[model samples]
Target: MTNSKLLEQFRSFYFRNFPDDMETQINYFSIFGGLGWDVDTSKPLTQLIEELILQNFDTLNEKIEQLTLNEPNNKRLLSALAVGDRKIFSAFKRAGLNNGNGGGALNYLQEKGIVQIEYSRESEANKISKHRISHKVLFTYPFIRFWFYFIYPHIREIKEKNYNKLFKSIQNKQNSYTSLVFEELSEVLLNYNLRDAQIISSGSYWDANMEIDILTVTDKMEIYVAECKWTNHRVNKSELHKLEEKCLKLGIKPFQIILFSKRGFSNELKSMQSKDLALYSSDNFEALLKNALNSTLIKSFIN
Candidate 1:
C-alpha cells in the first residue's frame, strides 16, 4: 500500500480503537502529525480539522472548557497539548504565520473564534494565552495539544513526498509512541479506580528535571507513584529502581510503584512483583483500550 494509504489505515485503526470523540481527536492528532508530533494520520491534516469542527460542536465545547479554565496563564498548556510539549513554540510561531491569513499552513483556530485565546502580561518572555472553544453549536473544535506537537510537522513527507528517512524516524518511535498513548489510557483507569476506591485526592507528580508520569494521593494522603515507560525494552529492576529514587526525593511513602511497559516485564522483575509494586504490559494496555472503546458512557461522544 502507498504511504498515505497506510497512514489512513492507522488513523482508522486508532479512531476505531479509541473512538471517543473520534473525528475531533483524529483531527487533533492530524494537526499534531503535520507539526512533527506523534499521531496516526491517513489524510490531509487541514481537511481533517475542517471536517471535525464542522461536524461536532458540543463535544468540542467540553474540550474547550477543559482547555480554557484559567485563561491567559494556561495558554502554554493549551499550546503544549495541541503540540507535543517538546515543540510547542512551532505552533505558536505558526499562529502569526500568514500575518493572520492562514498562509503558512499552521493557522491558529483561536484566531477564527473556534478556539479562544487570552494573553497574560506577567513577563514579556513568559506571555501566556489561554484557548477555549468559542462556538456553542459544536461546528469544529480545536485539536488536542499533543497531536499538534508531535504529528503536524511531517505532513510534507506524508503527502506524496519521497522521504524514506523521515518515514523511518516515525516508524522507529511507533512502538514506544503508542505506549505513551497506552499510558494515557492507564491514567484514565487510575482515575476511575480513585473514584471507585473512594480516594479523596489525586494529583500528577513530575519533576522538571525528571519525568515522574503520575502521582495519585488518597484521602489518607497515601501516595501511589507510577512510572510510565513507553519503551520497546521490557520493564526491569533497574527501571523500578529509578522510580524508587524519584519517589524518595518527592518525600512520599510510596504506597506502590506501578510500571506500565509497552513490552511486558523481564522474568526477574516478574518474580519481584509485590503488593508494593506491579508491572503492567501491552496486553493489559490492549484490554484498557478495549474497555474504553466499549464504554457506554463514552460511546455516543466518540462516534
Candidate 2:
C-alpha cells in the first residue's frame, strides 16, 4: 500500500481498537496490532496475542538482519537508541561509538525512515535561528520502539530460547515503556485542542540542566508549557509548581500552563484551575479526538 493509505489504515484501526485509556491501549496494541496480522476475534485473546507478538518479533528480526547487512554498525546505533525514549548525537557517542561514525549511522537511520529527528526549537532571543540547533532521535513507531527498548537487547536470550527472561524484563519496564507513548499522545492533544492558539512550533525542550515534556509557541507569540504524567495517581500542586519553576528558569512567561495526567488531578490542583492553568485527564483526550473529527467534517463541508 501507499504510505498515506497505510497510515490511514493504521489510524483507523488504532482508534477503533484502542481508545482513551493510554496504558491499556498501548498494552493491547503492543501484542495484537501490526501491519500484516489478521486478528481473529473468535480465538482466545491470550493465545491470539501471543501469536501476534511472535509474528512481529520474527518480522523485526528480519529487519534487523537487513539493517545490519546494510551497515554493520546500524544494530549498535539502534541499541543505543533503544536505551531511552530519545537521545541526541552526543548520547550515542557516549555509548562508546566514535562521534563521527555515530552521526553517520544516525543520519543513515533517519534517511531510511527507521528513526525520526525532533529538532529543538528553544528560542534564545526573539528570533529562532537554524544555526547551532540540536535534535533528539526517536523510533518512528510504537511497536519498533517497544521491540528495540525491551527485546533487542535480549537477543542472546531469544537465540538461546530463554523466552521467560525476556517476558519478565518487559513486564518490569512496561509502565516506563508506555510513558513515552503517553507523551506523544499529549503532543497530539495540544496540537488539536489548544484554545485560541495556533501552534507555530512545538516539541520537547531540553538542555544540559533540565527538560520540559511539552513546549509550544503560538503564532501570536504566546507560550504554552506543559507536563505529562502517565502515573496511576492524581497529579498534585507540586508537579505544577515544578513546571512553573522550570519555565521561570528558562525565562519563559507562559500564557498557559497545561498539566496532562492519565489519572486526573489532586484536589489542590483542581481547585486552582483557571484561565491560565489547564488540567487534562484521559477523558479530555477522548473529547479532543471527538473535536478533531468534528473539525475535519466541518472543514470538508466548507470546502
Best by TM-score: 2
Best by lDDT: 2
C-alpha TM-scores of all predictions: 0.53, 0.80
lDDT score for residue 24 of model 1: 32
For residues 7-70, write the lDDT of model 1, one tens digit per residue: 3322434544343443334323333322222333454434443344323434554454454442
TM-score of model 1 (CA atoms): 0.53
* Residues 30-106 of candidate 2: C-alpha lDDT, one tens digit per residue: 43333334454445434553576554566657766675554657777776776643566655764567768788888
lDDT of 1: 0.45
Model 1 lowest lDDT segment of ten: 133-142
| Candidate 1 Cα outliers beyond 4 Å, as residue runs | 1-151, 157-166, 286-303
